[model samples]
Target: MIRVVVVDDQAVVRAGFRTILESEPDIQVVGEAADGADAVSVARRCRPDVVLMDVRMPRVDGITATARLAGPAVVDPLTVLVVTTFDLDQYVFAALRSGASGFMLKDVEPEELVTAVRVVAAGEGLVAPGAMRRLIVEFARVGWPRATGPLPDLTARERETWLLVTRGLSNVEIAAELMVSPSTVKTHVGNLLAKLGCRDRVQAVVLAYERGVVRPGLP
Candidate 1:
């Protein structure tokens, strides 16, 4: 079963998510929290596979909660999916930077919500291509600091794979572009992630932009 912890300030929202998620035989809501501070406690106690987090909770916000639970500093991080009513690019970027595996609008369809949970649980990112592009553009507009120091040593093929990922290409699309098997593209992607020390593709893409491997306003 996919264990999930629902965290939101609104009682109604939490109940609604539980109802929708429990309707799936494969998913179980192990706990719920009314705010970010309580969310950390509940999640640690329950050790859920996925956390459905709200962005604007009182006390600690979802972005800070995500960093505590899933950030690079954590020894064994949990996967967090930021679900918020707002679609602001800043929130999306902040969530991803905080080590969230996915971000979804609160109005997401039931089917898509279920799939997103499954996807994040399987250790994959859930940001769509368009959202990712907007995130990058927003990061650039705000003049985010570029990555400092030497870049990780990646092979030519791995670098190519990373660029393709920043371009929002899936493994299948990358395979076709590189004229290689999909499995090969997957391998390259894995190597890229490992070398960059990224938790998921969203982080990888963010790192790529920060390191200037993929610049903004490019074709």
Candidate 2:
């Protein structure tokens, strides 16, 4: 079973998520938290596979909580799915930077929520095509000034792998596109992460955008 922890300030929201998650035999709500602090405490104790977090809470907030629990600073970070009522671009960017595995609007369909949790729990994220577009456009507006110049350290294969990543393709899709094995794609991805100093694919995408390697609206 995929253990899950639901964290929302509202009791109703937590209960609702619990109900939906329990409907799936593969999912079990290991615990629930009404605030970020509780979420962190419960998550560490329960060691759940996935955490459904609310962006705005009375104390700590999901952004800080997520950072504390799943950020690169964590020795062993847990996957965090940020579910927020507000779709503010800042929240999305902050969550992604803080190591959130996925983002979803609170009004997302119950079924989609379940699937998102499952996907993140499986170590795969739900970076939907629409979400990817939003992320690209938002970051494009900000213009990551520090990511200029070619990544001189990247190998030819690593550069190609980065293109696929910035295109929002998964490892499997990248492997197919490059006519290479998934393991090979994974290796390239790892190398790119190390060379670019990115914590994860989300950061890699951000870096690609800032460096002008992948412009917004590119097919």
Candidate 3:
């Protein structure tokens, strides 16, 4: 079972997520929090696989909470999925920089929410491709994680995998595109992420954008 903690200020929202998530046999909503401070406390105690967070709470908010749970300074970072009613880029950028594993709009369908949690749990994230690319590019300009300077050496196949990832292809799609197995693509993805000093695929995409290896709206 994939353990999850849902954090939101509204009781109804929390309850609704729990209902939707628990309906899936693979998912189990283990806990809930009403605000960021409590979210930190509860998550620390539960140590769930995924923390579904909400921004703009009364105390601390999701950005700060995400940092507390998964920031670079953290010894053992937890996976965080920042789900917000607001679709503003600022919140998305802040959350991602602070170590969120994935992001989603609260208005997304229940099935999408479930899939988001599963995707993050299975180790791929950043919601849909188009919006994720836009957010990473905008954040790249701000240069929070600093994807500048010389990129480490990468194998030709790894480089190919990286570009396809920047284009928002999943491992399965990349496998088919390259005529390679999915596990091979997974290894390539992992090797490339380590080489790029990226914490995740989202940051790797940002690095490519910052380095001008890829540009906006090019197919």
Q: lDDT tens string, model 2, 1-219? A: 999999999999999999999999999999999998999999999999999999988878899999999998899999998887656777776877788987777777889888889878877655554567776676568654445566657778898898888766888999999999999898898878888877667678766766788786565
lDDT winner: 1
Candidate 1 residues lying further than 4 Å off, grouped into runs, are none
**Tens digit of lDDT per residue, candidate 3, span 3-61?**
99999999999999999999999999889999999999999999999999998898788
Q: How close is candidate 3 to the true structure, as a TM-score?
A: 0.86
Q: Model 2 shows how many backbone clashes?
A: 0
Please provide, for model 1 over 6-40, each residue's C-alpha lDDT reduced to its tens digit, 9 standing for 90 to 100. 99999999999999999999999999998889999
Which is the better candidate, 1 or 3, if ranked by lDDT? 1
192, model 1: CA deviation in Å? 1.1
Better of 1 and 2 by TM-score: 1
What local distance difference test score does each model get?
A: 0.86, 0.83, 0.84
lDDT, candidate 3, at 109: 90
